[model samples]
Target: MTRTLLLFATILTSTQAQQGFGPLDPTPPAAPIPQILTHMAQQESAFANARDHYTFRQDVTFETLAPDTNQPDGAYHQLTDISFDDAGRRQEHVVFAPANTLQRVTLTEADLDDVAHRLPFILTTPELPDYTLTYLGRQRVDQLDTYVFDCTPREILKDHRSLQVEDHRYFQGRIWLSQQDHQIVLIHGQAVPQDTRPGHENLSPPFTTYYQQIDGKYWFPIYTRADGTLHFPAHADALSQTVHVRTTVRYTDYKRFHATVTLHYGTEVPTTPNPPQP
Candidate 1:
């Protein structure tokens, strides 16, 4: 018989604990940050790439509050199982998806992309040459001490699908590294939010992602959250329209997975079979 185990609880991140220290309040980075940042970026890239082999569950929720009254207006939630197919492709099966008032507003694909890939920026060795780094001193996360760094993309990248907007050009944000292991424990930042190209105005709320040690080796993203104002061009009614929103996603149920194989011998052998010698 096989047993099922629960590894960790769902992570609900709090920004209040993160605001305790500024990047340069007490002191600045020690020195030699450029080389250190590059090395750490490579490690982070390897870490993110390794997660495709594991299967986990994600719980995501979105809520909007009335700007006039600050009351909850609408909300939607879903629980999905993220796994890989035999061909080595990622798949998300929605275990739960509840209907809500989110459909009333126009949510473009770009808006969804902003929340998905744009916010959780991961710096790798390949992408390092395109950006510059700065030391942001130290910060305390829970009981662990971490080194902070500011990352800014040097040049603007052209959009492949459509005309480029101001926000789609660069990546500007901060990353937290564990002082002991140099693994990225947290990241707080977003894409440039200065898009003003007519109907293509791209606005993203600054979000923070927290990573936890898995199997005492690598740190993986376990929680992500953002609470900020969302402006849509389709907004007409002030009361019914939602400009302020709270989005939180929790990842849990981390279980190791590997393909199972059965070996066939020439014949079945019993453990307690009589000896061949007579």
Candidate 2:
């Protein structure tokens, strides 16, 4: 009996060694290039044109890397409720701005528009003609394996396809698309050079956005963070200060206009919407 027990223990140890005593993971397969790009373009357009189909709250926080500031020094938050305005045109309201750090920055309306929408990096159908992409490899984003690619715009021309920042400003970036669903899971990089543009020279900053699978169908940009240095104009007789800046945007309180059911305990249960309406 003792000899048999010893042999069993040795076999178990050898089996564990063979398994490497780590997470058992299968290698991700290569993505089908054309299929992913085509399907991704369609989904992006679907999400883009779904402006009125969904409404959620956005909270943005920023901190200037001043000598004494470490946490959030300022914040610009708002609830984007979709509804027909008095003029019968659909509009979203900036229902909240807890702290006026965004005002302190004094960004122009166009600049705010770019930040609120474009910074999140949505590659819609109209924007596809503007970029050229190269498959890099496969990368694991959290538990999801993603196909990596290096994307660059063909050019920044007026009336031509580009990111459409400012009038003719164009941005270049890399994108990580999910292998299973062909959704853009991550985006990294910033606007091309802007030094010659004069007033808008330092507006662009490097950032990364992580997309979360929402409603089991769409990959929504649930969180985005940008950290970089900026030189904004100073008050009279004062020189512009070069300060480190970090901006984080979070999306929550999702409300979808549909009913859904999920299987639970061998029975179907209604999945509640994201949260209670404010």
Candidate 3:
């Protein structure tokens, strides 16, 4: 009996050595690119659908000119408030400076959607004109694997064509999105005038938005900055008139209710209705 037991113990030791003393793990490798993209799109869609849309308050600060030199020692302030329904309809109000007087114009849903969709670098695609979106690999932001999308616009969007132009024609910028949450960590775009001269130039606006996830399915912009410059003509009469205008907006003091974070801009939305309400 003793001899048999010793033989069994030796056999067990040999088997353990051969098997590396552990059970084999058959887990597969990570999913491929297509799978990842599909997962992201699904998450985005779900988040979009489940989001609570509300009106946002906006404060705009424009660097003002000194009537003589147009230098920006002072700034003009404007305020706007906008809310959107689930159907994507928007109601916006605007307020003017100094007295915080309310403006008469109210924005419709179509107008709101137009502004949101047309906002540069907000929605990036391969089709925007002169604009290119390149995947610049990935990095970790806020403990999430983020894919970076870089962009550049084709030209300054001054004409009405810019309104109708596809996303392919818009300004170029960089967008960093979290893979796991599909949250936008940052989005920035800059547009520059191509036809303008070197010294006397019109610089396109730079837009930057920083987003944070509130609900599991939704992300909101916590901060937004829009900056641009206008160049006056160098000839006589225009030389003395130099105006550098800058409009900046900050989305802060967020109050999260359900899936929506009620936002307040620097200013109030103008409240003008079509055809002038008597």
Candidate 4:
């Protein structure tokens, strides 16, 4: 009897380690899952619209590390100010951009686009139908009580053209939403639909984005980081290689652009104050 009990305890510990979480609470949420999903989607839609009216600076860094030393052997760095033009057209002004030195992996346009948009993912009401969201129960994120959910795309569309490497990309990950505000506070996942074609391989690493309450109401992504190893299989001309890469993106200096734009969320129009300029 003693031996059997000890073996069961060992198995339970191993299972927890692999799953990354203990058993979820059997108690259901206060509201139905469908209702919760709709509310969260609406809040996210409002946040996305409000973010566009804010001007901020983004600093991005990507590095390929040496296996032995775990230090950067090659790197890419860029700093840009994101704001709207007089015509309210979104614009990005590069403050500083250095030559890329990465040798193993080349950064594609899609990768940079992901850094700008997908890293700070948003699932709006219209986008809700394109994804499948499953509630994973309640979890505490620092001091805030949050509801956890797994989000994945319903389909990955592929272009049939031989030259096209990728057509559509989607965020495949988990999100933590603040229970009080129904706003996303954190996202952990990666861009999916990575092309594994022999000669044209495109892969993305998993990443995490942490949001901070900006202007006292909206949760805005402030920092994001990704670390992973990408493997490229051998093709007709080249041999296989594995590259260890790390990326970090920081969004700061947020100030609401005083425009005529109006963003509404659940009948509430929260006032936003302009941040002090440096």
Per-candidate RMSD, Å: 11.3, 12.5, 17.1, 10.1
Candidate 4 C-alpha error for residue 34, in Å: 1.2
Query: Per-residue lDDT of 164-218 in model 3, one digit per residue for the tens?
Result: 3223234456777676654456777653322244334433346676677665456
List residue ranges in candidate 2 displaced over 4 A.
1-32, 68-79, 82-90, 99-104, 156-165, 168-171, 191-202, 232-240, 258-278
lDDT of 1 by residue, 24-79 (tens): 44365554666567668778777656766788887877777777798768887879
Best by lDDT: 4
Error of 2 at 214 (Å): 1.3
Better of 1 and 3 by lDDT: 1
Give all candidates' CA lDDT scores: 0.68, 0.65, 0.50, 0.84
Which has the greatest TM-score?
Answer: 4
How does residue 245 of candidate 1 score in lDDT?
75
Candidate 1 collision pairs: none
Counted clashes in each candidate structure: 0, 0, 39, 0
Tell me which of candidates 1 and 4 scores higher on lDDT: 4
Compared with the true structure, the alpha-carbon lDDT of candidate 2 equals 0.65
Give per-residue CA lDDT, model 2, range 1-278, as digits (tens): 99999999999876665532234234444546766787888888887655346666776666565546655555555555443333335466777656456433544454455456656677777888777777777766556667777777677433243333455444467888878878787888775534433345446567788788777878887887888877766655556656667767787776665334544696666777899779
Task: Provide TM-scores for the models.
Answer: 0.71, 0.67, 0.53, 0.80
- Backbone collision tally, model 4: 0
Instruction: Put down candidate 4 lDDT per residue, 24-132, tens digits, no spaces.
Output: 4535678888988899889988887787789999999999999999999999999999987556476999999999898878999889989977897888898888788
Candidate 2 similarity to native, TM-score:
0.67
